[model samples]
Target: MSFQGEQYPGVKAPAAETDGFRLNHTMLRIKDPQAALDFYSRVFGMQVLRRLDFEEMQFSLYFLAKLEAGDEVPEDKARRSVWTFSQKGLLELTHNWGTEDQADFAYHDGNAEPQGFGHICFSVPDLDAAEAWFDANEVEFIKRSDQGKMPDVVFVKDVDGYWIEVVEAARMADKGD
Candidate 1:
C-alpha cells in the first residue's frame, strides 16, 4: 500500500483551539536585492516595509509585506526596533555578498512528487486579473499539466530564485466555511 494517505492511520487531530500556527514569512536568498525588490513590487504588489543593512558584513536584508486593505504603517515607525502597533506578516529577503553560490535557481523537486516545495502562496481577490498581470509583465510559470484538478494557481520567481504562488481569495473564503 502506498504511504500517501495511510501514513498516519491513527493520527489524532489537534484541539479546536490549536488548529495551526500563523505563517510568518518565507525567507529567500537572492543575488541581487534590488532586482528582487522590483520583481515583487511589479508582479505581486508587495511593498518594502523595512530594510536592515549590515554594512560591515557586506549584506543587507529587506522585509516585504503585502499591502492589504487598511494595512498601512508609516515607514519611520517600522524602521524602529518595535512599534506600538501590531506588525503585519512580512517576507524576509536576505542578500549576502559572495553568498550567491549557494542559491538554488531551479524549482525544488522532492522525491517522486513532481511538484516541489513550490512557492509561497497568497490569496488574492482575483486570480484571472493577477494571471493577466503576470503574463503582461513576462513572468514565467510552470505548467500544471498533470497536477490533478486544482484551483487557479500561478507561479512567479523572485530575484533569489524562489517561487511564489498566487491563489484566489473567493475560493479561500469558501474553504473557511
Candidate 2:
C-alpha cells in the first residue's frame, strides 16, 4: 500500500496534501523521486524505506520505513518538504560530506596536491580550559586562540596534519557582554 491508502500498482495520483509535504529525499542521475517509485521499493518486500540526500541531513542514517500492505507514515501534503534537517549528526565521522553512501573514499585532507578540504570542528564547554588541556597534553598547536587575530578560535593540528577547529559558543556571548 501507499501513503495515501492506495492498493498495489495504485494508479491514482497522490492526494493534494492539505497539511504539508515532505522532501523525503533527492537522488541524481537515472533516478526519480515519487510515491510511484516509492511503492516499487517494496520489490525486496521492503518494509524499510531509505531516504537519499546529495549531502547530509541525518548525515549518518538512511531513514527507512516498512512498506507493507498497511503501515502509517507522516502525512505529506505541501508537495514534500518536511524531511529537511534530520536528527543532526548522530554518527559524526571523519570523512568528506556527501560521500557517506559510497564504499571507496577519496579525500584532499585540506592539504597537499588535490587541495580543497579543510577541517572538522568541535565545541567545548570551556574554551580556556580546553586549550589548557590541549597544552597540558602536548597537543601540537598551529595557533592558539590568543595568537590569532580571530581570537577565541583555536586551531590544532592532528597527527595526520589535518586541522581541527575548536570553538565555544559561549565565547560569542562573552564578547557581547
Candidate 3:
C-alpha cells in the first residue's frame, strides 16, 4: 500500500519524548444537542463526562465517554475537568444554537465528495446482537456486518448522518491480523 506524491522535508517534533501525550478526543458538530446526546447515550452506552456552555457564543460542548463498570466521574467541577482532559478516547459533541430550529440545516457528514473526516468506531462484544438491536431500534445502516469487503464490521448512521463503525472486539482479536 504505497502512493507516489510530493514530499516536503521538515523537522519532526519529538513525539517520542512527549511522555504524557495522548489523543484526548474527537469533536463532531451537531445541530441538536438533545438529539445527538440521546443517540449516543442510547446506542453506544456513552455518558456525558462534562459539558461546557457558552451562552454568548451560542454553542455548547458535550464530552462523552463509555466508562467502565467500576469507573467513577469526579463530582468536583475543577477536578472533573482535569480528569476528563486526562482520559483518552473521548467524543466531544459541539452544538451550535438555533440550528435545531432551522428545518433545512445540517452539518457536512464528511462522507460525500471532498470527503476528509471518515468515521468514528466502536468495538462491541457481539456483532450479531448489536446489528439486531440497531435494526430493532430503526437505526439506519450504511453497511451491515455481513456485507461489504470487511464482512465482520457494521457501519451505522447517527441522527446527523455521521458514520459509526461497529465490530466484534473478540472476533477482531481472534483474527490477529
Best by lDDT: 3
For every candidate in turn, the CA RMSD to the true structure comes to 7.1, 17.2, 5.2
Task: Give me the overall lDDT of model 1.
Answer: 0.65
Scored by CA lDDT, what does every candidate get? Answer: 0.65, 0.49, 0.91
Best by TM-score: 3
What is candidate 1's CA lDDT for residue 66? 74
TM-scores for every predicted model: 0.67, 0.40, 0.88
Per-residue alpha-carbon lDDT of candidate 2 for residues 1-177, written as tens digits (9 for 90 to 100): 445564667466666773454444322111112322332232212232334444533232243332435534445623222322332222112222445345463434565676766665667778888788778656778878888677898888653455667889977665642
* Candidates arranged by TM-score, highest first: 3, 1, 2
Question: Candidate 1, TM-score vs. the true structure?
Answer: 0.67
TM-score between model 2 and native? 0.40
Select the stronger candidate by lDDT from 1 and 3. Answer: 3
Model 1 spans > 4 angstroms off: 1-23, 75-81, 84-86, 98-117, 144-148, 172-177
How many angstroms is residue 84 displaced in model 1 relative to the true structure, after the best TM-score fit? 10
